[model samples]
Target: MASQLNSGSDLGFEADLFKAADKLRGNLEPSEYKHVALGLIFLKYISEAFSAHYKKLGEEEYADQEDPEEYLAANVFWVPPEARWEHLQANAKRPQINFTDVNTGKERVGDIGNLIDNAMDSIERANAAVLKDVLPKEYGRPQLDKTMLGELIDLFSKVGMHSADGKSKDLLGRAYEYFISQFAGAEGRRGGEFFTPRSVVQTIVEMLEPHHGRVYDPACGSGGMFVQSERFIENHQGRRSDIAIYGQERNHTTWKLCKMNLAVRGIDADIKWNNEGSFLSDAFPTLKFDYAMANPPFNISDWWQPQLEGDVRWKYGQPPAGNANFAWLQHIIHHLAPRGTAGVVLANGSMSSQQSGEGDIRKAMIEGDVVDCMVALPGQLFYSTQIPACLWFLARDKSANGHRDRRGEILFIDARNLGHMVDRTRREFSTSDIATIANIYHCWRAKPDAGLGAYQDIPGFCKSATLEEVRKHGHVLTPGRYVGAEDAEDDGVPFAERFAALTATLEDQFNESDRLTALIREKLSMVRYDV
Candidate 1:
């Protein structure tokens, strides 16, 4: 645990706080230290929320501040006396804590780590129904650095989380989200296991616009889809309670992170976790959601099993044993209501893959008129792999859901050129970019641009292609194949004159290069060698 001090950045939003925390991480790996930092942040968040509620309860003559139900009724976790942030901060620097056992008439000794662990335990015990075993309690391990841990606790205590910028910016939630991304950046592909980039998630949420319905994510990562959906609703002045959240995550650690991430934002979602995962052990087997949005692991080859050969979820066809791309598509399709719609993020290969019946499955979906729209995402947008990805928009009943009847036509947007580089290695969709893409999809769904409206397909950018056209191409949905070349601006210059001028310039450049080389050799020959 001495290495807990050795743990782990600077992002723009909460870069200063993260920089301070990184300095304190001494040598701890980002993966391990993230739990430590996040666990403390969760502890502090719930403690502070409870403290504020407890203060108000103290003024009520008949109120019993110790009553757990009082906090539970207000949607606040009941932090036990010893588990409070104030109590933890008071003992942060202590070398040892002495506890007198009243029942056993004995004394107990523990360092700050033990105290912190006990605090998490007590809090979990008090809120078992909601937060059972979600908090990390490994700080008590002797291998962790006590001094560094104390400094972290002290550091967090000095900072204001709720209203840092003289505004209710949900800075605590921002910090948690920011830390998840920072840790994801540090962990590389492993981090992608627990997170989807915010802009990518937002793009899906804004396009799908999961307004007032049951939203499901089979590969929900850290609940980013749900969070963004809720944010979208709020941003549009929609009621939060109008929507319900359901998700399933296979990895236990990522599930815990998702739980904490949602908790920080005060979102109540039914997120399930099983080692067998969404594919093998369908979590919401009998449930159909109105909206299903997800970013599944791209092109996983080892997810196939003999038991899935006859699985009912594979309605279109049995997915190949080597790739689960079609399996995920079918699973999401299986879970949609008659009028349900889904937006899925997959490897770009899904758009044009011809391997192992993936092409046949795509063709079947196309013929069934379920494929609605596809958008090609820009490269380098993910922290995980550089495999370019695309979005698959499907609707169960596209013609009858108050949408324009165009069952045979699928819209394709070539957005591989969208988004700007945020740093040297990463690119992100700006707000304008998200809005533009979302608007295009919305306009197309509302009505086809008869060359006079908002949805006109620009050459090499977007197109609404017919089923017959797709059939001619063997169901390869890569936008580039359909969108055509982007229209180029013209600077009128005659072919012969321009060719002659360009040739003369090239000849002159070649002659200048030869002259410079000969001149350099002559000068070297004239120079005197001393040794």
Candidate 2:
């Protein structure tokens, strides 16, 4: 898969550019440095894009002087000379004046922070909506060192980030994503609210197989889910234009990140921003999506449940004002079309929580036959919270596959033991790990009457539990309790001999415990005398 990616020598290769830039981060926080590095990358991308069109205008073949419409017609933003990359790189080493005319006279540039602010303003004026109020304007603070800022600019300039050809490459896009991931790692608990791990997003896309139509993310964070979905279609030999993406993000800063993220990937998505969130003011109220994917904030407390307590969208049961787990579930469920399927990540509590009517809501949804599968994911799979997470797959119509009209059965998979550690602190499923999980789901969901592969109750893995069986288990969807333990070993040795061996093992353990206690006391005495 890595080999299939765009394989070129990667011109202007400065692999350690970000590392060098980091060295200049004297007292600046990564949260602050994030905007600085990403802002420059955004500027570089726009400049390269502008230069590409500017050259064609200069050439005789495409010469159309005095016609800005020529460039606008091709979806290119018009950039002024001062905001262009060449001009910035030329003056990168030189100090420049900076001022804001807020009912006052022009002021001199006393710091690099002020210079960066003016640069962002110049870019915004050149191409209005392209960057309007998007750039982080807090960098001109006293905390950010002037020498460090200069060094970062020089480091970024060394790369061919300003060239027209660089626009065609996703080097900047990849770099931006890389930096976001690094920031997520740095800022552990708060990171999950903004970024979704690429592997988790890929798993959802792989399972849903969103070939075409609208893809939606209700709690889209930095737009990773939608971006991965587009890549999924492209990887499957489908045109990127085959899918239209839609999303809604509650946080304004995250919404801005989502916009920038989608723009960097060259994927057009109509992402909406509102502080009220999807529960209160659903931006896509009337919209039904063919595919839905999200990692909604886990166990969201204070989700304005009182305002939406009697809302019509709650078809299953009213989610408690204390927790929005079931509310997010029904919202995604309501958005699915007749044949639509959705993959959502939620807290482990949602799988079996009976607290505050959550269990009843889950039971109602189960009896209605929308829940297709539930996977218990390993802990530490998220950056935001350490709590265990699970993946929920919901389908609108199970009869489409002719699987005995399976409106009563739900597949439960316990994959808490599946992923491997990518680092000491985080775990991510590999491509094979993803395929293993997706293939299992596809296998179990195959039509029983269609003569395809049949589903089975694997003792240590998956089990297709019926509605009656689910009721017998009191609707607790934990897979381990249902799948049960594997068969006991049957050796040729007699049961009497085995019992004798077990008794001897127990006796040995008791004797060994006594010897270890004496060794501990000797070490304690030596340490006490030395003290």
Model 2 over residues 240-343: C-alpha lDDT tens digits? 88999999999998887888777766677888888999998999999999899999998878886457868887999888888888889899999987778899
Q: For model 1, how does the per-residue alpha-carbon lDDT over 330-403 read when each residue is reduced to its tens digit?
A: 99999999999999998877877788988899999999999999998888889998887889999999885766
TM-scores, one per candidate: 0.86, 0.82
Off by over 4 Å in 2: 1-17, 56-60, 65-72, 98-112, 160-168, 401-405, 447-458, 485-531
- Reference-based lDDT, residue 176, model 2: 70
Per-residue error for 207 in candidate 1, Å, reads 0.2
Q: Whose lDDT is greatest here?
A: 1
Model 1 poorest ten-residue lDDT run: 1-10
lDDT of each: 0.84, 0.75
